[model samples]
Target: MKYTEEHEWLRSEGDVVVVGITEHATTQLGDIVFVELPEVGAEVSKDDEVVVIESVKAASDISAPLDGEIVAVNDALADNPSLANEDATGEGWFFKIKPSDASQMDDYMDEDAYKAMID
Candidate 1:
């Protein structure tokens, strides 16, 4: 998995990538109350605002880290917003993307690098 400075996490499974906000981000936001997911088949650009997450403390935009076509969204989050707080990097994942440029992965931080940044 890789991470962006904006606190999104990404993991690839062939051409599709799983995406979510980092646990640190969810922690900072407090308990999640709502999620706005992208529609499947939507085209998105790097840095584009694709999702909205609202928590007890604040609402934040979850931006795309690479240009891609959204292939799946977490329908589970619709009825269970607190999943983000419970498992931000796992069951709480927000979407999946078929990245337009695989090389775009090179731009993100690996787990250690991302952890250090937060440390």
Candidate 2:
């Protein structure tokens, strides 16, 4: 339930998985303007490119933290990209996944490890 140096976070909600950028990423990207999300039912691999978040200064590719099939996407980001920057870990979530390999979750960092990487 933490993030990577690349700014992606992995959180599990029952069998579903949630992915999004970290607060650090938002700060670095500045004011976000657009978020391009993958379609539901699309398959994604660990570290695969799943989204594109555009900011006032740059556009960043949001990668997946584990291998999974996309089940849901945050359509709200299309109308309010700032939400990602405002609360990257909460309302800013980009996609929900149903992991193709549930055990792949073991490859991700824990909260302390993720925080240290960003700090």
Candidate achieving the largest lDDT: 1
- Residue 115 displacement (Å), model 1: 0.9
Per-residue lDDT tens digits of candidate 2, residues 81-115? 99998888999999999987888788778999987
Instruction: Tell me the whole-model lDDT of each prediction, alpha carbons only.
Output: 0.93, 0.86
The residue ranges of model 2 lying beyond 4 angstroms of the native Cα positions read none
Clashing pairs in 2: none
lDDT at residue 31 of model 2 (Cα atoms)? 97
TM-score, model 1 to reference: 0.97
Among the numbered candidates, top TM-score falls to: 1
Question: Candidates' TM-scores?
Answer: 0.97, 0.94
Please write out the lDDT profile of model 1 over residues 5-118, one tens digit for every residue.
999999998889999998899988999999999999999999899999999888889888899999999999878999988999899999999999999999999999999999
